[model samples]
Target: MHMVELKGVSKAFGDVDAVSNVDLTIREGEFVTLLGPSGSGKTTLLNLIAGMATPSAGRIEIRGRDVTHSSASERDLGMVFQNYALMPHMSVFENIAFPLRVRRLSRQEIERKVNDVLDLVQLPQIKDRKPRELSGGQQQRVALARCIVYNPALILLDEPLGALDKKLREYMQLEIRRVHAELGITMLNVTHDQDEALTMSDRIVLMNQGRIEQQDTPEQLYFRPKSVFAADFIGTANLVECEVSAVNGDRVRVTGAAGAFEVTEVEADVAVGDRVTSVIRPENVEVRAAGDDRESTGSDNPWIEAVVKDSLIVGGVVRHYLTIAGDVPVVAQQANSRSRLLLSHGDRVSLRWAQNDCRIIAC
Candidate 1:
């Protein structure tokens, strides 16, 4: 069942449309992330669902109840913001207990709830410490504990880990994922970090210019983007300009910098002679030996001779920047294995990939 639905939702500020004709559904236990750059309308959409801002158009439904006109407090949703929003004067226990107290819960019940949440977030020992006394990661966990203590059916997290250091941010990503899995509540998160979205979300809604460009699972969005914007936004991709040629069977021929290569892959409605963009992920490209035969390669193979320009080894992954035909630079990533070939600058290599690896967009 969809716990939340946004029907034709739109928000306007003066003459500008912040969220335009957006329709989305969140299932009862799904974690969906609104991912985009700042001013791309991700935050605005989250606000609409939270009832912090009224939509200029469309309806919002939470648990089959109309919430378009409801106030934030009436929505029964937990919201965590970029700022921890912790009271400087309050202890961790007090902060976690505040939400329940506002609802007028009994003193015994509030104590039990706060204790359970503190344990759930792994901060049971610091319940007596003030916010200033806690580390950044611990403070963020306290904020999360406070939000979930009341067991709200819906949770909205807006860059909740934005202020943490890099290592802490990565650790908190796993913590957030663990919480989402354990609670099984509908969660809608807004974040500009692509890696965070990919790491935590079941599905990602990529927004651009106040409109939804694409919404799909992480694998779908990364491997089969519907547009050039979607391709470039989700991950590192090499957008090569190409032209469509003959449509043979299930594939289409695309011409690019190297030469006319036969590729039988597409994700959009396009025809022959159309000017299209080919999206090839860096990790998809394979580096082959110089004497490799074209026939030995698959029929969908697009092979070109290139020279290794630079290399970087980060986190046990080999990142190779290859210059095809001496000028056009392309990138390929390979796993770090016990036996790996080292390609240095000016080393001649063959860049080969199966035709099905190419994804066509636009035109």
Candidate 2:
């Protein structure tokens, strides 16, 4: 197995600690994304693993060997940068062939490797074209092809599709996934795009201010965040302040602006009369007619009455901002074409969601 492990890795520049005591592991052939905003140390941590920078503390292991102090070349890693890093004067063929040439492979060997990689990235037809002659997506593919031409132990992509427009960027996400599957190589991607992370990763490492916030599968990170920051960052959430009324066994009653909401036991421990924030994803809140007799499907359902303030068509989903009965607003989402009700801006609505669907996040 070619899994990677970082044991308490830390990096600092002067008084600023870029990466602080971060420990992580990547299983063989798994595609993991390091996700966070700028300066969150995602890129720094990737660089440390790539051997472009040394960790101030902790050890980095590849497969089962210590590679903490190894040089970038010694690490046998394929790296693709945000800038594409193609030689301006070289054609795509020569550019992809450069890595193999560095290892002093014979001319025949270099040509074979370059041709195979170009084919793998679906850029074989453009091999003779220069970087400027190719489209943004094609150039990005060339860069990726160059990285994996030598078949490195792991591939590190640092915002490789950042320069492309939205449509092309999305197309590249799928293309990258296809390449990863074909090669069966462990991929470590650093990106700030939550959707991209959600779309492509087998697991996501959520980073914040030089520390790791949480690490889990994409579904876990999106639905069950461990902190308020994780909930807010992963997607749009309605933050509600609630006063804990009582706790009995696995049930807890919370009084809030929307009304009394009963939440089933989450992973958190709480006491009576404690103020807390409960987060509900917009997509989780169900929107129906205000007067509709919403039969209680289960004992764990939390229901609230709200009015639709506005409905927006965001991509394929309809995002509805709701004004609850008590003047507390919450955002709700519905499938753009899933509902028969013609929801408009000023329509009154009722929202219902199960207790397990809501996450009790700390404010």
Please give, for residues 213-306, the per-residue lDDT of candidate 1 as tens digits.
9999998998889999989999998778889877777788887786677666687767888999888888888887566554433465656888
TM-score of every model? 0.95, 0.94
Looking at model 2, how many pairs of residues clash?
0
TM-score, candidate 1, is 0.95
Top-scoring candidate (TM-score): 1
Candidate 2 Cα errors over 4 Å, as ranges:
295-302, 325-327, 338-340
Runs of candidate 1 exceeding 4 Å displacement: 289-295, 298-302
Candidate 2 lDDT over 1-363, as tens digits, reads: 547999899999999999999989899999999999899999899999999999999999999889999998888789999999899899999999998888899999998888888888887787888899999889999999988998998999999889999999999999999999988989999999999999999999999988999999999998888888898899898878888888888887788887887787354888888888888888888777856876766574656777778778888887888887667789988777865456787787778767867767545
User: Candidate 2, after superposition: displacement of residue 78 in Å?
Assistant: 1.2
List all candidate RMSDs to the true structure. 1.8, 1.9
Query: What C-alpha lDDT do the candidate models reach, one value each?
Result: 0.88, 0.87
